[model samples]
Target: GRALSELDSGMNRVQAMRSYAGDQLNRADRLESDMKDQALTQEGARSRAEDIDMITALSQVETQKVGLQAALQSYAQMQKLSLFNYIG
Candidate 1:
């Protein structure tokens, strides 16, 4: 009867250990899911901040190029009107 009682106690300890292991696995799964959600949310926010609107940026670039070309032409014309060329 003592041996049988000891066996029951051992079985109870094993069951308790199994329960603890199961709880740990459940916590790990919840943490993994939460991390995945956080990563996705951050990625979306980063895209909004860093990604440019192609049409607007392209338009601004085109406008600046045109302005630069006009400025260069004006500078060249001013250089032609200098009196230093004739005095050389």
Candidate 2:
């Protein structure tokens, strides 16, 4: 009867240890999933901040080019007028 009681106690300890191990494994899985979600969120934000919209950038460049061309033409015209006139 004593030996049988000892065996029951040992089985109970083993079951408790298995339950603890399973809880630890579940916690680890939750933590890993949370980290992965955070990493993906950060990646999306970084892409939004760093990635330029090509069409918008191209339109801005074209607008600046047109403005510069207009300014150059105006300056050339002023130079032509100034070169021909003499003033004290």
Q: For every model shown, what is its TM-score relative to the native structure?
A: 0.58, 0.58
Candidate 1 per-residue lDDT, tens place, 1-88, comes to 9999999999999999999999999999999999999999999989986897989988999999999999999999999987898787
Candidate 2 ranges beyond 4 A from true positions: 52-88
Show where candidate 1 strays beyond 4 Å: 52-88
How many angstroms is residue 35 displaced in model 2 relative to the true structure, after the best TM-score fit? 0.4
RMSD each, Å = 12.9, 14.7
Q: By summed lDDT, which 10 consecutive residues of candidate 1 come out lowest?
A: 79-88
Q: Write the per-residue lDDT of candidate 2 for residues 1-88, one digit (tens) a residue.
A: 9999999999999999999999999999999999999999999999986897989988999999999999999999888776447552
TM-score of model 1 vs. true structure: 0.58
lDDT (CA) per prediction: 0.96, 0.94
